[model samples]
Target: MRETIQKVGGRLAGMVIPNIGAFIAWGLITALVIPPGWLAELGIIGAETADTLTGNLVGPMLKYLLPVLIAYTGGKMVHGHRGGVLGAIAVFGVIGGAAFELSSGAAGDPPQFLGAMVIGPLAGWVMKQIDDFLEPRTPAGFEMLYNNFSQGFAGLGLTFVGYWVIGPVMSAVATAFGNMVEGITDAGLLPLADIPIEVGKVLFLNNAINHGVLTPLGTAEVAEAGKSIYFMLESNPGPGLGLLLAYWFAGSGLAKLSAPGAAIVHFFGGIHEVYFPYVLMNPVMIVAMWAGGISADIVFVATDAGLVGPPAPGSIFAYLPLLPSGGGAAGVLIGIAVGAAASFFVGSILLRMFPVKDMKDTDADADIGDALEHIPGISTV
Candidate 1:
C-alpha cells in the first residue's frame, strides 16, 4: 500500500512539475486583477483591467487550459503523445460536465482539477489498451491510420462520459471534501489536521495533497467564503523556504552550492518540488517542515484568516493577490513569517546534527528530480 501510494503520488507530481510555467502565468494574472496591488497603488489601474484580464485570460486558463495541461501531462506520462491528446479530450468532457452544478449557493463554476487527474490517466490507460489490442492484428504500413482513428473515436467517447458523468460526479466529490474540511474548521480541529498533512507531503504526497484535496476544497470554499486557508495550509513555501535558507548558510560541499538555487525556485518560482530533493536528502528535514506546518496552521486558526482565492503555485508572490483584506491579510502574513522563522530555527538545528560533507552519489544534484530523466521532453527542460 505504501509503495502504491508513493508511485501514484510520484506520477501526479510528475504531471504538475512540468507545467510550473502555467501556474506562474495564472499567478501573475490573478495578482494583476486584485484590488490595492502595485498596479492600483501606482495608479495604473483601470476600471476594466481586472475584468478584461480575468474574463479573457485568467478564468479560462484556470478553468480550461490548466485541466488540459494536466491531462496532457498525465496522458503523456502513461503512453506518450497519443495518450496525451486523448487525455485532454477526456478532460474536456469533465470540464463540460461541470458546467451545471447540482448544488445551489456555490460561488461560481466548480474547478475541474480533480476531474483532470481522473480522466487524464483513464484516457491514457484506455489508449494504451487499444494499442495493445491493435498492435497484434494490424497489417503492415497502415498502422498510423488504424491507431489514429481507434484512439480518436475512443477519445470522443470518453469526452461524452466525462461531460455527462465523471465531471459532475467529481464536482460533488470535490464539494464533499470541502464540506469535510469546513466541518473540521467549524469544530476547531483544522490545526490538528496539519500534522498528518505535513507528514504526507514530505513523504512525496505533496501533489496529491495539493491538487487532489486542497485545491478542490479551496475552490468550493471560494464560491461562498470568498477565500479559504485550505489552499494555503499545505501549499505555503515557508517551510521549504526556511529549510533551504538554513542549508544555504550552514551546509558544506555541493549542498551549499545548490541550496541557494533551490531556495530561489522554491520560494519565488512557487514550485515546491525543487525543495523535495532537499528534504529527501535529509529525512530529518521532514520534522522541520512539520513544525513549520503546525505553527502556520495555529496562526491561521487564531487569526481566522484565509485567502481571497486559492494561490496558484503557492509562492509568496502568488499568495499576495489572494491575501484577504484587513485582518485576514495581516494574519496570513504573520503566519507565514512565524512559520518561516520556526522552520529556519528548527531546520538549522537539524543541519547541525547532520553536518553536510562531500556530496554522495545522488547528492551532487541534490535538488533535482531523478524521475524527470524517464519522462519525454523533460530532459530538454
Candidate 2:
C-alpha cells in the first residue's frame, strides 16, 4: 500500500513539478489585475487595461496553458509525445464552460483541474496501449499515417468522454470537498484542518490538494467574497519557510547548502516544491511544519486576516497585492510572522536532536525520471 501510494504520488508530482513557472506567471498576472493590487494601486496602468488583461489574456492563460501543460507533462511521462498530444486534447473538455451538469444541479463550466490530472493520464495510457498493439501489425510505409490518425481519433473520442463523463464526476467530488472545508471554516475548526493538509503535502500530494481541491474553491470564494483565507490555508509559505531557514543556519552539508536557496524560492518565488526534498530528507521536520501551519491558521483566523483575492503562487510579493485594504495588511504580516517564528523554533529543536548528516545521492533525492527508471517498459523519454 505504501509503495503504491508513493508511486501514484510520484506520477502526480511529475505532472505538476515541471509547470511551476506557469503557476508563478498566473500569480503575477493575478496580482496585477485584481483591484487595489500592484498594477492597479501603483497606477502603472488604467483599470480598463487591467480588466482586459485579466479577462482577455490571463483568463485563457489559466484555463488553457496551465492545465494543458500539466496534461502534456503527465502524458509525456507515461508514453512520450503521442501521449502528450492526446492528454492535452482530452483536457479541453474540462476547460470548456457549461458543457456538463454537476450532480448538485450546478452547470459545470471551467471544470476542476483535478479532472485534468485524471483524464490526462487516462488518455496517455490508452494511447500507449494502442501503440503497443499496433507496433508489430503496421506496414512499414503506413506507420506514420496509422499512428497519427489513431491518436487523433482517440484524442477526439476522449475529449467528449472527458466532457460528458469525467467532468461531472470531478465536479461532484470537488463540490463535496469544498463543502467540507467550508463547513470546518464556518465552525472555526480551520486550525485543526491544517493537519491533513500538512500531511498530504509532505506525502507528495500538494498538487492534488492545491490545484485539485483548493483552486476551485478559492476561485469561487474570490469571485463572491473578493478574498478567502481558504487560499492561505494550504499555500502559506511560513511553515516551510521557517523550516528551511532553520536548516540553513543550524544544519550541515548538502541540507545546509540547499536550505538558503530553497527558502528564497519558497518565500519569494512561491515555488513550494523547492522545500519538499528537504522534508523528505528528514521526515521528522514535518512535525515542525504542522506546528507552524496550525499556528499561522490560528493567527489568520483570530485576526480575520484575508486577502482581497487568491494568491496563485503564494509568494510573499504575490501575497501582498491580494491583501484586503487597511487592517488586513497588518494582520497578514503578523500572522505570517507568528507562523514562521513557531516553525523556526520547533524546527531548530528538531535539527539539534538529529543534526543533518552528509549523505550520498539516493532515490530520495533523485528526480522523478531517474527514480522511476527501474520500472520496465515505462520510458520517460
lDDT for each residue of candidate 2 in 255-300, tens digit (9 for 90 to 100) = 5765676588789877675666566556677788889989999898
What does the lDDT come to for candidate 2?
A: 0.70
Write candidate 1's Cα lDDT for 112-221 as tens digits. Answer: 76678778888889999999998889999999899888988998899999988997776565555444444555466877666656655544344444555566777788
Q: What local lDDT does model 2 show for residue 326?
A: 53
What would the TM-scores of all predictions be?
0.67, 0.72
Q: Model 1, poorest ten-residue lDDT window?
A: 359-368
Clashing pairs in 2: none
Q: Which candidate comes out best when scored by TM-score? A: 2
Clash count of each predicted structure: 2, 0
